[model samples]
Target: MLYGAMKVSVGAGLKVVFRPRVEGREHVPARGPAILASNHLSFSDSFFLPAVLDRKVTFIAKAEYFTSPGVKGRLTAAFFRGVGQLPVDRSGARGAGEAAVRSGLEVLERGELFGIYPEGTRSPDGRLYRGRPGGLARVALASGAPVIPVAMIGTDEVQPPGKLVPKVLRPGIRFGEPLDFARYRGMEGDRFILRSVTDQVMYAIMRLSGQEYVDVYATVAKRQLAEEARARKRKSAQE
Candidate 1:
């Protein structure tokens, strides 16, 4: 109820004011288990999807957002929990993939919506990087749920890196047709097969978003860049 309502109200407002257009909304199931596979561009990408979606799609958030220690923490926790966000430890300590897959499948079994960023992390340079066959394929295979490919474009401009507050820039969301791996129905636990399915879903998102696609995971590139920048700064200071 809150998810659908927020999506309609906020999404409509953005459309009227900022002219952010959303396509393929019909792809969203009115009720039933489904996966929202999208490209990770901006943090606002998380906010905007629920605001515009008709169904309540529950997202898994970072542990910090749910574990903060004050008024801000309380507010953040309340807001995220209210919006149906769950926190999962992404540090991948133990049984990381299995844990997330279990959580996602449980939600699907309960006939609820689950959201995932296939790229695993945000695109470092505003480009759609490769997909990590994270438990997404497992969840889909386990629940037989259709993965809905979503693309959020220009949200980076709305909330760029290092920005404390969001600027009122136009943002657009496009939902591609839901991807079903019915063909691979009995093939769970096959890493190679799961990766192939993920690639097809990601290709759909890349086409919808028009961002250049990188063959490697987005986070890997971001980490390397950060290291290189730090090294360059150190050398410059010495010079």
Candidate 2:
């Protein structure tokens, strides 16, 4: 199968090239359904995380990655599929959240590993932003799976936002102790409980990543930066 072959080939190739140092992998459950909740830094976060793991970690990706047209798009789609990523429509926030949770639940029900980013989007400034919950709480609660906090250090520098090729930099992957939310089992509908659970996960990630914590969402931070850039450009033009 393409998945098996690529997993071995890609994993071997990356080990030789990036020489990633993975720590705390012992925390990942060798078998059974578990949530790998991590801080997103670069596009390579998905690839690097799964590459290091012995088990196949499936993550929900944007549908555009699968639905793009033409030869290049097909290759991209195939590559994502080969690497065990599921495509979900990320259009409306509410709808997309629901769809992703549903897909994740299905994966968990099958007793497989599911990966998610608690921060919703990559940190634009490398500071760990406030987690969006983004149904991560709901999924973990619903699936009754232990949440493993993972940190992908130095990935942003190796393959930054706009870069396609990665530099031969050693990134570290650390997995923290698994967090159990058994007490909040039946309270998935509680927004306050969700926020609390998500914050706890983010805190664990912060400790592992050693990145400065920002109180705002990454998307909001990016928007603010864009607006500030526009304002500066306008002021310069007027001057």
Candidate 3:
């Protein structure tokens, strides 16, 4: 299979180059469906997490990664497909979250691993952000899959924002014990239950990652940080 071949080739090289240190891999079920809820730190989080796992962990990616213009776009699409990424249109449609939940539920229905970043986006400042209580909780409760809190360490340092070449450093991954929310099953429609489940999973990730917890969403934090940078620049120009 293409997935196996790509994983072997790329995963082998990644191990040789980055030499990532993985812990509690046994926390992952040897069989059956599970949700890998991880803190979003770096773009490489997608590749690195899959590379180290024995089973394929499919993540819902933006549709743009699959559809674009030119040769680079084609290659990007191919790579994402080769690695088993499911694309969902995220262009301000209310259905975007619904589509992602559907995709995740489908993957779980097949009894496979489904990976999700509860933070919704990469941490703007290397700190853990509040988990979005939408797709993650909906899919988990609907499918009754065990949610595993995974932590990726040092990935940002190895591959920081806008960096072309990754630094040679030993990143780490830690998998916490599965957080079972079976009690919340059939209650996915309850917003309060969704928030509770998402918060519990986020707390587990925070403990495993040891990153400072921010009570805000990553997107809001990113925007505020950008505004602060612009204000500083304007002040400097005026001076």
The candidate 1 region of ten consecutive residues with least summed lDDT is: 2-11
Please write out the lDDT profile of model 3 over residues 55-110, one tens digit for every residue: 99899999999998899999889888878799999987568899999999999999
Candidate 2's C-alpha runs over 4 A off are none
Task: State the lDDT at 27 in candidate 2.
Answer: 96
Error of 2 at 207 (Å): 0.7
Instruction: Pull out the clashing pairs in model 3.
Output: none
TM-score of each: 0.91, 0.98, 0.98
Q: Candidate 1: which stretches are off by over 4 Å?
A: 1-19
Q: lDDT per model, in order?
A: 0.83, 0.93, 0.93
Residues 67-138, candidate 2: write the lDDT tens digits. Answer: 999999999999998889999998898899999999999999999999999889999989999998767999
Model 2 residue 76 distance off true place after TM-score fit, in angstroms? 0.9
Expressed as tens digits, the lDDT of each residue in 168-193 for candidate 1 is 87788898888889888768779898
